[model samples]
Target: MPSSAAHLLSNHYNETRNEYYRQLDTASRNGGDILPFINYAVQGFVDQIRNQIKHIRTEQLRIVWINYVHSRFKTLSSRKDRRRRDLLLHISEFGLLHKNIIGVMALKIYAGKTVTTLKRDIGYLRSEELIEETLTGYFPNLKALTAFLPVQRRVVE
Candidate 1:
């Protein structure tokens, strides 16, 4: 009924993980257990290896999008712990149109950091004030270009 994207992005992944465990539990009852399989065939098991690869590939994409979406929510929310109480609040706050790809790219452009020396001073390059908290995570608050655009004189016919 309402916007489900936020609920989906946050809850869906966790639900999937839960589902996997449930399957494992069922498999345990059916056979012996998955722990034995994991322990014995740690490296050479093709099925396990394939499953891991599949999980990672699917989960990686979800993480990227979900993180960005949550960042947007955090930026907009007026609370300190701005987490979704349920799907309803989430949908009301971040509508479908607001879930934008361009916004995500803008966040990356503003906050992206290089893998440099951890011991090196971070304050030189990073600004704590400019970062915005979204429901998902922290994002660099990128100023809109329109505010800085030069005004153009309109010629009347």
Candidate 2:
């Protein structure tokens, strides 16, 4: 996990633990059966922490994919070239970018460039293995994440 994810998980865990303690104290003072409270708190904490861990994994993957794209496509010197980079980032963030969706995106981001240019950019990304051609459309090749698996394992652990 990255520093931000780790910090957030730590804060959430501490907060949940503190609340569990508070509940336990209240139950003890009131002479109530604390077993139910303990069970509920444990279950809720486990569920919330599991969700947070999944979210952290997703965020980490997105970050790694974006960084890989940036490293591969560093020469964003012209507006046209920059648009290609933007397109790649868009694909990375939101997968299944079909031709029709790309056409709409072209009108917004790749303005002034012809549809041919947009296609060419997509072709270039495919050639570089930065994006993959799926039955639905283009998607960022998350295989790039494998290269950083060691680092990811260390951080997550």
Candidate 3:
């Protein structure tokens, strides 16, 4: 699955290269300028590489976040504790966790658990500095992104 992106990108690059060569051949046969075709292909390559880099960085950030969550909450072994962890993970998917959002998630996931329990779980995550409260609602702390910075720096270098 991971290699799918690389495979698709490789196929795109090959097709682009072939088309560029074909264009160059046609322009040469017609005694026309080839600079535009060269420039266009270069731009496409640059854009594709930039997008791939962005995708890589995003994947790295996700891995770091998941690892951080797993390590920090490793002791949450019991079923109830796991539910709290699940609540944290699920809430992280949303932009914010307000009353309405929490209520909806509670109905879907909490089952026997109460809304207050869900709120308490959120509070616990806040105390752990894993999530932060804002004027709008709660969000996973941006501090977690720090963990990915070193890896990103290495990739950039």
Candidate 4:
């Protein structure tokens, strides 16, 4: 269960973000009152979501995605500009680990660029040392380069 404070804060942040989106849309379409403050608030909310997601378990990412509703997730909406770098890092890292577990099967998932985009991202990730493929297709990378990324399972447990 989430702490009471966490629950309340999440609720508050979500509501505030939605309000800002509504305001921004109205201002853009109808004109007037489209304050820069609305944009700033939306950016802050997006950052908070990104920061919080960084702390979440991989398995729980889908849960967070499901529970959180924002313009960010809309099919036609673009990703936030500031998040591009972080997202690239995540996509690269995920691609690498995916290769490790799934072997050549990873080729099918491709990260970007083409139908093989996931494969391309993983290839780049290996070059960056975020992960490495011991063999051409199936094998765990000897070391993971993402030292700061939280590992889902701790050995002590």
Error of 1 at 78 (Å): 3.8
Candidates 1 and 3 compared by TM-score, better number: 3
Flag regions of model 3 displaced more than 4 Å: 1-30, 94-99, 106-108, 151-157
Report the C-alpha lDDT of model 2 over 12-128, residue by residue, as the tens digit.
456678776777788888789788676766566556667787787888888887877777668666776677788889877677688675454445686766778888888988997
Root-mean-square deviation (CA) per prediction: 21.9, 6.1, 5.2, 18.5
Displacement of residue 3 (Cα, Å) in model 2 is 14
Worst-scoring 10-residue span by lDDT in model 1? 117-126
CA deviation > 4 Å runs, candidate 1 = 1-44, 79-157
Please, what is the TM-score per model? 0.22, 0.65, 0.68, 0.22
Best by lDDT: 2
Q: Ten residues in a row with the worst lDDT in model 3?
A: 148-157
Predictions in order: lDDT: 0.39, 0.73, 0.70, 0.44
Model 3 TM-score (2 dp): 0.68
Task: Please name the candidate that would achieve the greatest TM-score relative to the true structure.
Answer: 3
How high is the lDDT of residue 111 in model 4?
A: 30
Please rank every candidate by lDDT, starting with the best.
2, 3, 4, 1
What shift in Å separates residue 149 of candidate 2 from its native position after superposition? 2.9
After TM-score superposition, the amount by which residue 113's alpha carbon in candidate 1 deviates from its true location, in angstroms, is 41
Looking at candidate 2, the ten consecutive residues that score lowest on lDDT are 148-157
Clashes of each: 8, 2, 0, 6
